[model samples]
Target chain A: MEAALPESARGGVAKPSSEADARRRRAFIYGLIAFLLVASLPFLPVNNYIIAAVVRALIFISLGQAWNVVAGIGGLLSLGHGVFLGIGCYTTGILFNQYGIPPWLGVWVGAVLSLLVALVMGSMTLRMRGVFFALATVAASLAMVQISRHFVDLTGGADGLALKFFGNSWWAAQSRTPAPFLYASLAFVTLYYWITRWILNSKLGLEMQAVRDDEVAAAAAGVAVFRTKMLGLLVSAAMTALAAGLYMQFYMAIDPEAAFGLSQAIQLQLPALIGGLGTAWGPIIGGAVMIFLSEVTNWGGTKIGVSGVDILVYGLMLLVVVLYAPKGIVGSVLRNAMKGADR
Target chain B: MNAPAVALEVRNIARNFGGVVALRDVTFSVREGEVVGLIGPNGAGKSTLFEIVSGNIRPSGGRVAYFGRDCTTMASHLRRRAGMCRTFQKVRLFESMTVRQNISVAASQCLPKGRDLGEEVNNILAQMRLEHQAERRPSELTLADRKRVEIGRAIAGHCRLLMLDESLSGLTHDEAEHLIDEIMQLNRARGITVIVVEHVLSVLAAMVQRLVVLHNATVIADGTPSEVAHDPVVIEAYLGTKQKALR
Candidate 1:
């Protein structure tokens, strides 16, 4: 602890900032290495199940990154992120299935629609306390599920809408193999990661964090508190919509259960919650860990012949992480590492 | 000699919570580059007036003007960006951010376009002599250091007028003196207008050019510290009337 003190505090000259810069550079290198290792997975001659699972992992990673922007960075804890995803999935699937619009263009339309939903939602709930905000989001999520089921003609009700096959076309965004989705998910994850990082470093990000810590202080510091929170929610929703569009393209199907379900809501948050909230790499690592854990636990559950054992593991994992490593695995590790460096 | 320009004006400001009046018909103006003190006893509405002037809370009536610009309807953030900054009576630093980051948060927002924010942050860190503790968070610092960081944040950019609400509270005598020195340096060297609210009249009298004494939501006296201190009405309201009950 004494070593952590600056030399100037001990009557010596102040140390230069080179040490902080070096730590940042090192962390960047490690993140790059992790990204490369994941990028290499599709090249291996793996079975379709394995490939499909990795694609699913990548999809969740993208969702988690999007969620992190609002919930973690902006401090607006949300449980209804799936509502945006639902909007995207339904918008893209319905447009393409009925009007023959290409998925690529439909995705952008979905993004705009999702942003509008976020604008309304944020206005309604951003001023609420954290738990109240979360509950409001949960209500929104459930409402979206009901809306999906109610609109049978547009959303296909509980039966769902599957995109008409167009063979392998970039315009349709459809692929016979999961390989394309694996790569597409890779692109989405990478894009969301960079976007999250950009936001975290930008002036808006600083103000958002300040607002999160203390609204009065942030207002005093020249931050427009409500505007900052709304902007974060809009960005997060738009990104979630884009990822949902890709999910529609990959699965060729959309259903109320999959789009706005409790399972998906938890899935969307677990990556950031487990990896590290408010960090670009958190979802990347967290999503991978979540998928890996699910696979292992699923296999174990089957051997034990228990019901819903996989979900039980998830709850247990969340409890432990919240208790012992509230910063999540990556956050705790990096914090400790920084503390060590300080010493 | 030309009279100094009015840096801030509060006219007939009034506020009430339920039936209780917080401030009533309060009015004052601060001159550019002058250091003024707002001394009052408890529940005198000094903090409420500070909030109204800083744009954090709206006044029930009247107006607040900055450099003759009516800003009563403006948001607090816009007030800060327009060169009006303030500190809280209760210290309110961003808890998760390090001291440097807290200062930089304000610097990044309030600095003029094209000014290097990092340079301004470094300059403030040096000016506040907080370089040694720049990486530490608010919780890690002592009360004096936390106050320094908060003030450092308030002055991080192009500050024209500063309002400090009980900024000297919760400090030892030596610590309070050191903090006062920092505030004095900011006013003397940078020509920034200052309005400070304090309970310690002795300390404030020495530090400020003028004092506005508030008692029961209205100004009882506004004059040089010496004049206000000797005013009998001020003594009756602020120092208490020594009229004893007849046995």
Candidate 2:
């Protein structure tokens, strides 16, 4: 807000003032430049597949960064956060299909519903700890999926809901171009990235991290742990929901299983888990890596004569990364770089 | 001791943990800028009293008033905002963060809004003599340094009343002396009230202006160090006269 820390001190732990302030400012400028570059990539010579893959990666980055707000900073390991995404996607899909609401406005409907779901989920699971909290989130998400399926009249049930871009409105859901969708995803992800960065630098973000590091110590320091966790969950759910709305436009179909599935939940973690949960660029790096791995696995599938080879590759890579670098790739790399700098 | 203002006051407080009575009818007042020592053997309810006064463990009975306001049922954060902060008996720090970051967390998170956190934090670091080790993490510090960081963090808050729970438990004699000097400066120069709970009698005697002796969940003695030091019950509690006489 007040410029930020010094450029040279960017990766180093923040000092009270002086050099760190300059680094913070420089880092912010760098972030803005990076966002602009990524946003302009769809207009470049990249293939449609490459552009689409980048868009998907950006969407994952947004969701991962959102998840970090609650899981990394707030210390709430919500394993079933895909429920918010599912709610968002379905809300937008249903609105666009049944009520002729444009996808642009539908995103808001999805975001609001996700926020409500987060409020209810947070109120129930925010008090639980460790494995209990994780399990509770999974169970709650599972229940939401079941409910969506049971209401087959509104949702297409297991058959899924197809969204046709027939509505009039230049900025609404009528466009068939992947370029706009890519740009849209990039813009949303960039906005989320900056927002999360701002939040991490704010008082609320610090309080959330305090709760994460040590709840008892944070309480002694006067941090309201429950309130911080709730706020983190609300913000996280809203962001995930927005990403889900964008995703519906990209895929053009939504079903309870595809939207709220455990695989989707796992996909949400790939970015953060691989990048470093709380680090600013962790989500982007993790998202890029996952996207690259999927592309590679797809090419390798023809040689290996296997269609679902991507999941196997992902599983093995994650296992290796976790075993060798429990802090994730970006976290380990940053730690090493800092160590080198200190030396 | 500076007679600046009333730092903390407790009126008829009681606490229960399930069926266990942690404290019963505990009432006392702490003066401004005085290092009041609270001492008891293990399971004597000293820690419980500290928790209640610090707003960690809510008292099941009675009110805790600080700086002329009733904070008996106030949330810990509100009390912290009201300039009441404390450190744990065991060291608890942001293990993933470096020492300076841990102290900075207290500054950014606990200090009142718009406070000149940079200057205040720098002053605290200088006072604690922790400037050189700022870049190091909590896990890398020695037992004494880790404890100092924990104390430094509490001191960095907007603190009128500073509560320490066995902060010097594992410190060497030299380290303890250095820390005691800092604690004294916090009171004498800044008018910060201190409630130090410790099992170390000699250090407690040298540091505190007044003494509160607790035993079996109640206040057993309250007075100056010299006066309370010679009390029959105080000596008996500390030395275990029956056991010492038989030996």
Best by TM-score: 1
lDDT of 2 at B30: 93
In candidate 2, chain A reaches a TM of 0.88
Candidate 2: residue A225 Cα off by (Å): 2.4
Candidate 2 wrong stretches, greater than 4 Å:
A1-46, A127-132, A167-177, A338-343, B1-5, B109-114, B241-247
Best by lDDT: 1
Task: Please list the Cα RMSD from the true structure of every candidate, rounded to 1 decimal place.
Answer: 5.2, 3.9
Show the lowest summed lDDT stretch of 10 residues, model 2 chain A. A2-11
Question: What is the overall TM-score of model 1 with all chains considered together?
Answer: 0.91
TM-score for each of the candidates: 0.91, 0.89
DockQ score for candidate 2: 0.43
Q: Which DockQ-derived CAPRI band holds candidate 2?
A: acceptable
CAPRI grade, predicted model 1: acceptable
DockQ of 1: 0.38
